[model samples]
Target: MSSTTTSITCTGLTFGWPDGTPVLDGLDLSVGPGRTGLIGLNGTGKSTLLKLIAGELTPLGGAVRVTGELGHLPQNLTLDTSLRVDEALGVADARAALHAIEAGDAAEEHFTAIGDDWDVEERARATLDQLGLVGVGLDRTVGEVSGGESVLLRLAALLLARPDVLLLDEPTNDLDREARQRLYAAVSAWPGVLVVVSHDRELLGLVDRIADLRPDGVHWYGGNLDAYEEAVAAEQEAAERMVRVAEADVKRQRRELTESQSKLAKRVRYGNKMSANKREPKIVMNQRKRDAQVSGAKHRLLHEQRLEDAKERLDEAAEAVRDDAEIRVDLPFTAVPPGRRVLTLRDVELRCGARATLDVHGPERIALLGRNGSGKSTLLRTIAGGLPAVAGEVETHVPVRSLPQRLDVLDDDLSLVENVARLAPEATNNRVRAQLARFLFKGARADRTVGTLSGGERFRATLAAVMLAEPAPQLLMLDEPTNNLDMASVRQLVAALGSYEGALIVAGHDVPFLRDIGVTRWLRLDGELNPVDPEEV
Candidate 1:
């Protein structure tokens, strides 16, 4: 591997979990310089493959080769709370070395630590400012920054390192609209091998190619996500057409087999009658009867073979079509009548120094838009009674439930069924199981413990617990609901929300998702809550 070039290669890669669940087996991949969006449904090993390439995970039976320095920003980010911002950006040691040299220490080790990077602090601050972190100071501790800011800070460290190859797993999970745009600018201008594993459609649209990880292997699409989607749609259409043709062929073959059998039966009856009437000599009649029997057998076998071949073709064609199921939601019990007062906020002060005052009526859907630390989540928590307001009044006329971004509402040891039962105590076990099925947890899936579920699966379980509560929440609030979900799971969430007739307050940066859920009101939380048009954001 040459340091001058940038690339990633995996040959004969095979990996499995400790439980012996195979993910990638005998796989081969080559990613060259450019942005590549690695995408697939949940549990398809998109994240696993990225981890393997980034050396976070070792393959069981293969090798991974990289040509240049690499940097990786994982989905779940953790930073030491006591570390200063400059330390978190990986410039503290260099800054210390520079200071020692300036103080006339004349130490060889300080020079070695500083290297040619004497202005490390300036570069680190510049990187932070590039990612919309101007307000975050160099001396501020990691604990003082918001979660979204922490994500950007990690990215800033990666930028300062200036690796030739970059890997980001769900990089925009916590970014607000403004922060995401800044990150997008960085991705667009990146001049190296950049591979991102994400479900953010806007982020994926910035890639030069699409790497779709499936059960078979990696399928490469020549362009961005939109192009990939178009190619897939065209392929599916052709596959469905072939399936229809194969089905018709099967039907035709079955008809021919039936017709052939009927003809053979008639011929046998005629021959038997002739023999009985002695129309020909006994030896001749016997010979004719044997010949007819052999012919009929050959005809029957040929038709059966044709039908079998057609059915096989049909099965193959059907396999090409995806069967990603959507959630089935029917929550008549959660509906709020028109003109009903659902919630009211009067001069309420939030934990993040934001104030709000509003009245939510009927089944109005509101989108709470804001920057990373603008107090959107705080306002929702105050309304849900999870947090107390510093000033003013908050009231709700109906049962309310809030699904926070952390999704910590469920007990890890409990199964989906048990968790739903805990929430909806009055509902029978049978009834709860039936509702769980609507959330796409059927049979044994419903019995799987929450701890063992994937990110998407756990989200569904949490959503079920809240939506299926005993009194049936007429007012439902969600904080960053689409943060960790795959595209399929996002769609499933939209489908589930389609059936909810309650007043909704959703806080997040996913405007497309908000639009898909039919949000009627758009509000921004930036020190003060105010209404805004959807297009302006």
Candidate 2:
């Protein structure tokens, strides 16, 4: 990949949904040869922008131009399950041609197909291995790999293509810890123009720059996530200070307006009294009255304008400060005694060939960690009763609820209020609305159908339904809860989890998040459950 020449540029870009919901408008961006992290809240058009650049979707206006060949890995990847690994990687024809030539078929077409890439097979295998696809062979079907591995396989395909420009959307969302490390390495080594939209902090830290998408426009920051955060924090502080100054000016202007009005009224009263007492000539008194009225009116207008100007300044300053609200809730009923048994898994053998016996007591917070295809999600599903275990007993002493990675708990056609109501039938409408409000879905927001909600909104609604279910789940399980969530949404999840006083079994690759939620026990699955030190993970 060339380092100096490749680039992606968008000019006067504008886009809107079919329903007339506008997204980007007159947006212009220039990405040079380097790793750039694209980040924003869910629905801020990070993915949409990537799609436009990748030519997956046409913009409503303007144009996108790339200086070199491009490869894209979208957030939602759909590949044919019957496709062979080599076919999915787009090397099946070349591989076949090379084999035919090696078998002594000296055909012109085979030679053309093989071209100068005689080492295509070795490169493919090496790319696979580099991405931690050790056992995944070219002959294996796509259906034979796990979901996380499938993501890596697609990334491997992109890498083998060797395009000068690459775009990845939430690439690590499906990857496990080890696979994410491999991806981080690939991203670090990318020498051409690269733009990735991701919520993974570790992945963002590998970038040379950050493109933060906001409603106003894209704001560029020089460095990684931490650097962007520090820059933003300083900006917020300055904005806040400006807001305070503007507020004080507004107050002062209001006070001055009031004082002027008071003084004007007093003058009016004195003039009337003088006129009534005949203290001066009639004509002179009339002239004095007229002049006083005109001066007072001018003074009042000036003060009112000052107040208005101050208010406008205050509004402007306030706009500069972000309001990323977090979730806050109290779930006292979900609390468990210190000695109570929450869950017991006896000799549990998952369908993915992992076996473990686990006992969760009290409010133990457990982190389930593993590589891709290591059966973490499988074990979670088995314990959640969504999948039957191959062997052994799974029991929960208290009510259990699982928040799956896909967030399939809610009906898309139904509104959030309706979904939560279905799960908590005994709760009154007002009660459900109150709780939903805490989840940041207030009033009409809660009435919107789940299908219309954004990823973050859907996550919050699903979590609300599960945690606020009728029986009050004292044992909660979440699988990859932060997979596609934005940073704000991740913080909201942490805040919501903070209020849950129940035993938790969270299976995820986000170690920072797991630690933030206070995971008391670290368990790694590798054909068996093994205790891992928190520091090691």
Candidate 3:
């Protein structure tokens, strides 16, 4: 690590994805040598910015200069298959160069850059201990670890390299709350220039400053997420006031100029009727000319200036503009047609693996509650006709659509439009585009591969396809719709679900979201379904 403090500075640096819309515009940011959390909505280029700083991506314009060694975890992690935890930190590369140096090979420069380690296994074991993987065998295979565990191991590998600058993207997405706490604690103790892109509000609150990258440009506030939001909110109000004042001044000036012009025309016409010898003095004529130019020209100038000022104000105010008026999509038939036999689960027992049984019934917004691997997903899968029951009967209505948590229903290799089109083979591209627009995926965005979309976008697109089917599914099964959504986006989704008709059997652990969406039925993962509780579900 560099002894001197390292910093990341960008000047007019901007970039976007390959063959994608412009995500950044003339962005400038100066990051001090400390942990700074990146905050932004989808397609805001937060992930792209991290890649620029870490040297994975070259800026399209200007520069991104980081004065230190850098290491990064991309948004997705692809591990070296079956590699032991101890051997995963590029130690083999470190050792091979050491051997080459001793043999008088051309790896001299590599040896100079990477110090010869005492022993590869020793170094790897030490890194594993530091990362809270204390008792796990150093030689354990990566394939044996769980998804969250694998994430922790990958992060540990990056941390072991001891880069002067560390960039992490959505580091906590797969980990549990406790694991996130453990990682955060380690980050707090590290002495490096840290840059992280994440949507976790708690993580955002821990940063030194918050940088928001919107479509317009990039802006940073020297505070936490809450403070940044408050500042942005204040700017929104100030910008609105600026626009209103400029508009009022323009209106007032134009009206006065119109009246003044009328008077001037009358004066000029009357003066022409007078005899040349008897006309007013030259001084009066000059004064009148001066008055006309002052009022008329001043009006034009002020009017033009105000128009420009108003446009600028509008641009700034657009950051938090409430264009999406909370139009409560009033459900045409808010209540489902009460059928005596909505669903029938006869002695149906769901056993995911070694243990776990979950049973539930119809017209229910049943919330399947559990931690990771608690059989919630397995139970929901069976309900959606994904898994075969061991020994039971499960019956549901026709035309059923399910927005699974992972969207297993969606074809990863297919484009979003194609995936939606599978349900209606005759659906034209224009029709598919219109349906996708309601969920905000519109146009070319719908043409992107379904596997490439972020979690939230995928969920929205899946939900859109679900609701737009020919015979709208009377029974909708949603499994953790709010899992990857940011707070604002989650709220928007809850509103959409609230407006949805049909029988919803949502499986989520978000109690507050369940209450807000008017869920009346609750099903515990361990037992049969029950009515929603006033206090807890």
Q: Compare the candidates by TM-score and give the number of the best one.
A: 2
Kindly list the per-residue Cα lDDT of model 2 for residues 180-299, writing each as its tens digit: 889999999997889998899899999999999998889999999999999999999999999999999999999999999999999999999999999899999999999999999999
* TM-score-sorted candidate list, best first: 2, 1, 3
* TM accuracy, model 3: 0.74
Off by over 4 Å in 2: 1-6, 426-429
Over 4 Å off in model 1, which ranges?
1-6, 19-22, 426-429
lDDT of each: 0.90, 0.90, 0.67
lDDT of 1: 0.90
| Model 3 ranges off by over 4 Å | 1-4, 18-20, 58-63, 87-140, 250-363, 404-419, 426-431, 442-459, 478-484, 503-537
RMSD values, in order shown: 2.1, 2.0, 6.4
**Model 1: how far residue 493 lies from native, Å:** 2.0
lDDT of 2 at 25: 94
TM-scores, in order shown? 0.94, 0.95, 0.74
